[model samples]
Target chain A: MTWAAVLLLAAGTYALRLAGPMLRRRITLPEAAVRYCGLGAVVLLAAFIATSTMIDGTRLVGPTRPAAVAVGAILALRRAPFIVVVCGAAVTAAVLRLAGLP
Target chain B: MRLIRRTVVLVRGAGLLRDVIAVASAVGVVGASFGAMAAAAGVAPELTIGMSLLVFAGGAQFLAVGVIGAGGGIAAAILAGLLLNARHLPFGLAVGAAFDRGWATRIVGSHLMIDESVAFALAQREPERRRRAYWMCGIAVFVCWNLGTALGVLAGGAVGDPNVLGLDAAFPAGLLALLLPSLADRVALRVALIGATIAVVATPLLQPGAGLLLALIALAFALPLPARRPGRRP
Candidate 1:
């Protein structure tokens, strides 16, 4: 199942990437459609982030994870480098968990 | 032909090459994190490495692995990955000119069409520079990302528990970081907030992937309303 998913995703993503270059002359996406597609991607990602940070296997996790993620989000907003944001989150979570916040 | 000749001469400088390397190295760090997180979540190293090589989209790959690691069904993982990569359609359009030379180049270049490469390509004013930047960034990122993933898999094997090190938090954090730039747009921000709220609310009530999938409803809010009737009152 995992293999199937991976392969399917690979094929699908490749097609999307190729579509514009290959089909640009044949068809053009409406401006509104294009904007919506970008918006939809952001929505999906936001939902994923919320779920992952706040839930664990259908159960709500302690506040520590969310707090750590908040730290990461703040850094990201400030244009901190990727590594810094990641490390900041990890360190925050680790320290919080260690301090018995979990 | 003249442009090609000029491109060859311009390529002699190491300035762009250095810039590409810097960007690739930064991307490599994220790639390593993805590999490590996937392995720690019990994903096979082969699959982790395969994703880095094939998917080549950092955000989608991470989301797919995260979904699967959370026991979300394979179908859900695929769906999420596809949804996250939908932006590539516009990306392909924006940089399509860089890959128009030949069928082989087009096919290979399409596979390498990623956010960073497209951004780099678009930043250049000249057509030749755009093509060069696209290929250089794409190729560099591909190599560095794969190498980082391999190294990460090795390191992940040695780590005892991801949660203890707070590595579990890193996944969501990385994801949020990626999503931040998109949120800068007001409409996108509203949509994301609604979508996230729906997902969080529905999570415990639905199956593993269902909640996240449900978030698609939020996109309805983003749709352009029917052309306002010409005579409609304000």
Candidate 2:
């Protein structure tokens, strides 16, 4: 089942990635869709971030994960290097969790 | 003469090459994190490595692991991966012009059209330079990412406990970092904020993965109305 899921996803993702580069000239999206293409990534990332940080098995995870992620986001917004963002988030969560905060 | 041309191209692209190395190193480290996360989720090291190798998209792989580990079902995990990677379509379109026109080139290039490669290619001024930068960054990322994943898997067994290091939080944090630049655009920022709110609110109401999938609806505002023809009435 895992292999099936992984292979299917790999195939689908490959097709999506190839669609524009191979078909850009031959195919054009609707003007409405084209206009929003750039924002799709931002929306996807945002949604994923929220879902991952906050949700677990239909229940909200503890606040530490979200708080840690916020720290990383703020640093990233400030244009800190990627390494700093990663380390800062991990440290924040570790500290928060160590304080016995659920 | 062929070798000389290659050397000249390499020398001319030295600065871009340095930047590419820096980005690749960063990506490699993230790849290591993904591997560690996968291991912590109880995935076999081999399969974890396989996920990174085949999926290739960092965000999608992390989402896949997150969903799968949470008992979200295989179908839901696959769907999430697809949605997470859907952004690659626009990336392909944006960088399509940089790829040399040939069946083999397009096939290979499309496989390598990740965020960094496309961004690097588009930053170049000339078509030839763009192609070079694309291939350079793409190959570098591919090699480094896989290598890092392997290293992490080997180390993951020893560091079975990821929480002590807060690796659990790293996934969302890393993704947020990636999202920051896009938030600079006012429209994108609004869409993202709305999407995030929807996802967070919907998490408990919907099935696993649905929250994020439904959040895509927030992008409706970005869609333009049909172009009105100058002399046409609706």
Candidate 3:
């Protein structure tokens, strides 16, 4: 079942890769769609990030995980460069560990 | 013959070799995050690096790692994670149109047409600039990614108790950082705010992937709400 899932995922992703170039002309999305497209990219990226970080193993690891998230958010707001963003996350995580939170 | 020269130039511009640093900057963080996650999970450091080398998709890597860490079947994790990546299809298609297709060019373009590269290419108003940006970003990502994987994996291995260091934060924080620059509009802001908040609030209620998927759908179907006119100055 798992292999089946992974293969399905891979094929689905490949389809997306193939689709981008194949249908470039046929679709004429409205201005709203276009704007949303820009937003969608960021929005989706955030949603993905949220899921990946806050919830692990179907439970929220509040102290360590959320702290890391807050650190990332702070770094992002400060417009810290990418390396700084990573460092903030690392430090948040390190603090969590030092506090003995899972 | 003029067109041939242009296409060659376009392809060269789009491929990863020319602007290696830009690509690395974009792909490196994501690659490192995945590399570190894999390392933490008792995945052979080689496999972690290989994910960057081979998979190159951060969401998919996250999915694969989450599943693996839980001892979920490898195959299942691969599949679920991939479902999230399906969005790339339309993104790639959008990019593929900018270039006239030939067998080799099409194939290569498809391989390189990731979200960042494609968006960057499409964002370019000029045909040649579009092509060049696309290729450069893609190639940069590919090259930097493979190299960065080694760094991340080694870093992961060297850190004692990778969990304590909060290495997992790299993936989300890195991605969030990549995403922030792109959110420069109002409708996008609203929808993103709505969708993101929904995801955060509803985190307790839904699967992470499914919750996010739902947010995308809600944002997409949010037609009944007033549509903001362009240049209207919200």
Candidate 4:
């Protein structure tokens, strides 16, 4: 049932995308509004990421995950590529494994 | 030949892979975060990948997964996801106006619409540049994003706890990446800051539904007052 729901929602998302150009004549947003819309996307993305990482499902925070912390830090300071961060975090994690540090 | 053209267009539309990966790790963290939610929700990890492949919108998918974890009906979850993604309409139209290609190309370009994809496309001033860059960014995001979701799911399924690696902390860092660039001037900065402030205060007060409402309200307050810029080209 839920899978069906997921699929339907996916289609709905694509539908919204498809409908945009089709209705370009009917609906118009100001350029500023449009630009802010773009910024808003980034803001929402930021908001989503921020709140999720801060709070576990039912708790405020969880136990340590230093390697993931390393990944986030590297991303921030260096603005390093995503692959580097993922790889670094994963490798950092793998190293901890090799060092018996969970 | 045209298929390849479309493929190049897609690749070029995404920012270079270097740039894509620059954003991908943070996205990966998001994916892992969602994976944790999905795992806890008892949704199969593979289904999460399928959601990425099909829906491909991170925010919507994240919200839906979050809802599912909280025992919301699938219907309500889908409805909320659609509402959140409603902003894509204006996004696609903006890209459409800026697109100087034929109708076929415009239609095709519309399919690539997403948060970052539209932003990247509009950031460019040239037509071919816009097309190629937008497609490349969108495609790159598609590849990394879906793959990252899969990786997260795989990790989640095997690992007992998401916190073992401190993935919880990845959010602010990731959001920071998204927020820093859009602070184009004082207004944008104020808007973002105020929105963040509102989000922090509202998160615990509202359920997921109400929190999104608060985010939208905060976003509206932060956004310019909907007055069109005087000199923008049609």
User: Which candidate number has the best TM-score?
Assistant: 2
- In CAPRI terms, model 3 is classed as acceptable
Question: Per-residue lDDT of A1-102 in model 4, one digit per residue for the tens?
Answer: 267977898888878887766666566776565666655655454444444544433234432334454465567557664445444554455455546654
Q: Rank the candidates by DockQ, best first.
A: 2, 1, 3, 4
Q: Candidate 4: lDDT over CA atoms? A: 0.60
Per-residue lDDT of B1-234 in model 4, one digit per residue for the tens? Answer: 999999986775444555555555556566666666676677787687788888888778877877766778788789878876776664665566655266776656665677666655554557777676577777777777777777777776553443345333443443344345455555666655565556556666554334434555655665345445557866
Return the lDDT, model 4, position B24. Answer: 54
Candidate 3 lDDT, B1-234, residue by residue in tens: 999998986775544233335335646655665666667777777566655544566667776778767878866686666666665654554456555366577766676655556545644567777777677777778776767667778888553444555666755675566556455545555676677776666656754556666667646645654656646885
Compute fnat per model: 0.77, 0.75, 0.55, 0.37
By TM-score, is 2 or 4 better? 2
- Per-residue lDDT of candidate 1, residues A1-102 (tens digit): 367777899999999988877876567778666566556656766787788799985799999999999999899888887667777998999999999998
Q: Native contacts recovered by candidate 2, as a share?
A: 0.75
Which parts of model 3 have CA positions greater than 4 angstroms off? A1-9, B1-54, B65-75, B93-106, B112-137, B144-165, B201-207, B220-234
lDDT of 3 at A90: 71
Sort order, lDDT high to low: 1, 2, 3, 4
Q: Clashing residue pairs in candidate 1, if any?
A: none
The global C-alpha lDDT for each of the candidates, from Candidate 1 onward, is: 0.77, 0.75, 0.63, 0.60
Model 4's chain A TM-score stands at: 0.56
Candidate 3: residue B69 lDDT (0-100): 76
Give the winner by DockQ.
2
Share of native C-alpha contacts between chains A and B (below 8 angstroms) recovered by candidate 3: 0.55
The backbone clash count of each candidate, in order, is 0, 0, 20, 21
